[model samples]
Target: MIRTLPYRTAAVLAVALAVAALPLTTAPTAHADDRACEQYLHSKKYQIGPRVNQACRTAYDRGKGPNREAICKEMLLKIEVKPSHAASACRLGVKP
Candidate 1:
């Protein structure tokens, strides 16, 4: 017994699978993923790893208001070493 999806259905499925394989942060922009954040952390002697990445993702997701850049800056400033502020800075056009 052999069954195959219609061409259109197969095309849709393929598109869905391709989209699914993409990194999760593609939508709403990947602000939290800019490499400058990691560089900033490294410059500050913080290790560029999971905790920092998680913090950035959290900050980006939580960011709100007409000034998401400012919101991100405020959030990151409260944390001393763990959160990287470079992405915020990059978005805000300010230095981290």
Candidate 2:
């Protein structure tokens, strides 16, 4: 029973290590996505100014996947902005 006790303890430790690593594995993806979104909005600072820039960022936060990109594009279009700006901005915001 003493020898078996060591084996059980090692098994418990290994399981604990794996469980701790689980949450960490998914953290980088979300963080990277947010950074990408912020960088995209930041890039448009000169062309859109603060108001539209904030609007674009808000739209991006509210959206997900392709829908998020679409929302940003729509916001830009509503303001009658340049097509190139909208397209590139939305593309970067939604990029993985």
Candidate 3:
């Protein structure tokens, strides 16, 4: 019974430590993802100022995959860019 108690306590402690460290592990990864998304938007020449920069960043985050054009078009329209311009922006930013 005494030996079993120590083993159980160690198991609980290890689990607690792992749970406590979870956020620390994910925060930097998310921040890095944000930066990478921003850099990609900049490389596409879309972020001309603060307003466009935010929109481009958001578009990149929300629309970086197979449906990127449709997703980005919806988001860009919220900023009042013309439909043609938004479609062109989406088409230009990604490779086929």
Model 3 spans > 4 angstroms off: 1-47, 54-63
Q: Which candidate wins on lDDT?
A: 2
Using all chains and alpha carbons, the TM-scores for the candidates as numbered come to: 0.34, 0.48, 0.39
All-Cα superposition RMSD per candidate:
8.0, 4.5, 7.6
Model 3 accuracy (lDDT, Cα):
0.60
TM-score order, best first, reads 2, 3, 1
**Could you tell me which residue pairs clash in candidate 2?**
none
Name the weakest run of 10 consecutive residues (lDDT summed) in model 2.
29-38
Evaluate all candidate structures by whole-model CA lDDT and list the values in order.
Answer: 0.52, 0.64, 0.60
Q: On lDDT, who's better, 2 or 3?
A: 2
Model 3: per-residue lDDT, tens digit, 1-96? Answer: 989999999999999999999998877433323244335545655555565555444445544666765776677677676677666655544432
Q: Which ten residues in a row have the lowest lDDT in candidate 1?
A: 87-96
Our model 2 lands, by Cα RMSD against the true structure, at 4.5
Quick one: best TM-score, which candidate? 2
* Order of models, best lDDT first: 2, 3, 1
